[model samples]
Target: MTDLNVSVSRLSPHQECALHPSFKWKPVYNLECVFCQSTLCVRGMKAILLADTRVELYSTDLPPSGATVLVEEDYETRHCECRIKDIACALCGNIVGYHVMLPCHPCLKSCNNGHFWMFHSACVQPHERLDHNSNSILLWGSLPTSTQDDQMHSSDNLQWTECCR
Candidate 1:
């Protein structure tokens, strides 16, 4: 298999363009559920930034203000029709994420479906990770215990923030 992990500084201009520079970490291939290894979304999938909020992933904190944190578009294989979809591991049925419902306001009429995909970084494991300063790193087939510790403690002092339903 090709080494999907590539250092950010060495990325081709085209590849850089494909990424949201504001995001701290990005996957090199489609993410898979750490529990079941079921594919979730492909690498280079653009995320939609929610205003003035941060999400607590398993190991890292995601600040969405200027980052591509929420995935609005679903990959072809993981499409859902429910207004509030549950993102589960296909093989194990472990709920790993959510498809939150977006309000249908006057300004937003394009997404008639009223929902988007948001996978918890803690629940899904990336096959390859893009490191800004060094070569891409390979993640484990399952989430590491240290990462779980990070996720578990990240929300302790956080103020309540609104997320999609």
Candidate 2:
């Protein structure tokens, strides 16, 4: 059994939260699995938007601790022939996403480091840490925006009014 060897440095909290410039969806820390509510990844992480429903995380960004990569079967993407492995929730064994094993040249050019982990939007949810010392969390389907219309999306099964802090 191959387990994800997580370095403690990868999970360290950031001094300040910095949102990705292109994607203003949410701050990239304290994301949790939608099914089991286990923490997927946290702190100082950067993401690339593969699609409206998928987000990609670089290998350096610390892949989800609660997920494991299954190397049993290799699959290719329809858009690109990049080989990938399925990523499953370590705790619940639910297929959460995929990890890129090999990237074609074109994919490498656009994929920054040529490798990343992709998570489905519905499979994972983002949470804001209200206080570093406290366990309080503010959960939302989407980031709070200036306009009420864009404050939350119903498909994510989260609402701005459901804050737990």
Candidate 3:
């Protein structure tokens, strides 16, 4: 994977122009829930400035601005719908959840189990998440569950980790 840039760098001026200087892109990894094996939602991406392809993580306590972070790849032009903004497992980049951006939120299990999920609303089915419904709800940092099987990060004392719904 490419190195990450967590610094507050200059927003890609080239983001507006088709012609511009070459900029290196980085791959951000998402964290998944141990229970239900679902990807949890997470704070939005924070753009940072850097000298080169190397990435330097800043304060983790900082909250991400809730917005869609664009990537080097075009969501509609460069790839198919699934490849556009598909979310992947943190441990493995498999198609775990859907998103309109790369490294979308964590699995749903993370949310339903009270685990912190990191995802953009565009990444999942409309009916699956409660935030999208007209219920006038806000479930960030909270788990999204439809069944009793949903459990937050499994116990550390257990011999195995739970990461599925």
Candidate 4:
């Protein structure tokens, strides 16, 4: 047998979520993946949600047709579906994450996994459910580059920082 990550989802109301005042419902440490420990960072440091997270929607290179089927579902008022799409990261040459095509963006996005196909009302256009034409297809790009001194940087550098000053 293998170990599975245990978790609790005590998501509450009156916290900021996709649109309403509701909790963001993230794991402890305001983190994403505990294993890889990669959360969207900006300005050379950790990014706090909303403090940093802006609702975004990625338009697909294809018209949501050429991708492979993954999963789909419907609730009393919402629906979702996942698809596999090809994507490339601009920073480094690595691949990750599902191009999860949801019938809607109210579902999951980023977690222990990097941001997947997710969207909020702000990311969508008015009078429409999806702005697929303007959205960038979600993809696992590249891991953050690092230096010998154990510092994470965007570009390639052989020299490492001495003490992270």
Candidate 5:
């Protein structure tokens, strides 16, 4: 099999385009449910910057084939109150993340019109499929763990401050 060169980088704090003209795009990766290893998202889905322990997926992208959004429920984050639906693994029924139904005012711009989906970093694993014709996959190890020093470095530039705990 041909070797794939994947550049995985820590997600930076969100910045407005007007202030940061040269924004770098993070590479996309396939994600799988950590519990059952079922594919959650394929390539072409880029991770958006949220909190350190969550992975954000766009609502416009194809929904995960191995998961489903459940009924909406009230949820509270550190900074705001919102309504969200739990995203569970279809194969195992494990709660992997959530879809924002009603975002708080500060999160409205980031919510993309209720199209934001978040996956717990601990519940999903980032991976790469070696070949589309086969069932082979390459796990990318654990998601990035944030340290106090790292948090201090980027705290001033955070765009989306509200996050589910």
Candidate 6:
């Protein structure tokens, strides 16, 4: 079983005790699969407003639909006016959370254009929530070719320092 201290909640006013106030609604770390520790999305992907203050919505370019298999069950919320599909880890098959597409809410755009993963905070492991003002670690994406040589060196140092300390 995943070493998740946080409990999953489907109800609104989600378990607030599990979240850090500073990063409660902010993308402050990578969202990883609780079962396999595989990264699903990173911090600062994009933010979306949801009706629930307890639930924070973030947009991910990580093949939102294709990567994970959706469960047979789905839910439609009148508040959001959208259909939600329960998404499971493609590898471990754990019910991570759900995603909504083309919701009626103004804050939430049509996810059909891209897609948004409404992850259950408990279902995801928040990695690298460290506060640093220095050269930000490259958690995802490739370094530009021009700065590749310099960045690789700096990235190694950053990782070592971050990991060790």
Q: What's the TM-score of every candidate structure?
A: 0.37, 0.52, 0.20, 0.22, 0.50, 0.49
**Residue 27 accuracy (lDDT) in model 3:** 16
Name the better of 1 and 2 by lDDT. Answer: 2
List per-prediction Cα lDDT, in the order shown.
0.39, 0.46, 0.27, 0.24, 0.47, 0.48
lDDT of 1 by residue, 1-165 (tens): 355554433444543453334342433334566785645443322243232126433212221221122334533222223344445644456776665554324314432211145567777775544332354552222112323433223322221221211
Query: lDDT value for candidate 4?
Result: 0.24
TM-score of 5: 0.50
Residue range 1-165, candidate 4, lDDT tens digits: 124232323333422232222212211111112223232121011122221245233222111221112233422221234333433222222232224443233334433222333322222221211112333221111111122212223211311121122
What is the lDDT for 12 in model 1?
49
**Candidate 6 clashes between residue pairs 3 or more apart in a chain or in different chains:** none
- True-structure lDDT of candidate 6: 0.48
**What local lDDT does model 5 show for residue 119?**
68
Clashing pairs in 1: none
- Of candidate 4, the 10-residue stretch with the lowest lDDT total is 137-146
Query: Which runs in model 3 stand beyond 4 Å of their true positions?
Result: 1-39, 42-72, 77-83, 101-165
Q: TM-score-based ranking, best first? A: 2, 5, 6, 1, 4, 3
lDDT of 1 at 114: 18
Q: Which regions in candidate 4 have their CA more than 4 angstroms from the true location?
A: 1-81, 102-115, 118-165
Show where candidate 2 strays beyond 4 Å: 1-26, 43-60, 64-66, 111-115, 129-165
Worst 10 residues of 1 by lDDT: 156-165
- Model 6 CA deviation exceeding 4 Å by range: 1-28, 43-49, 57-59, 63-67, 109-115, 129-165
Cα lDDT of model 5 by residue, 32-69, tens digit: 77897765554323445343225454321334332444
RMSD of 4: 17.8
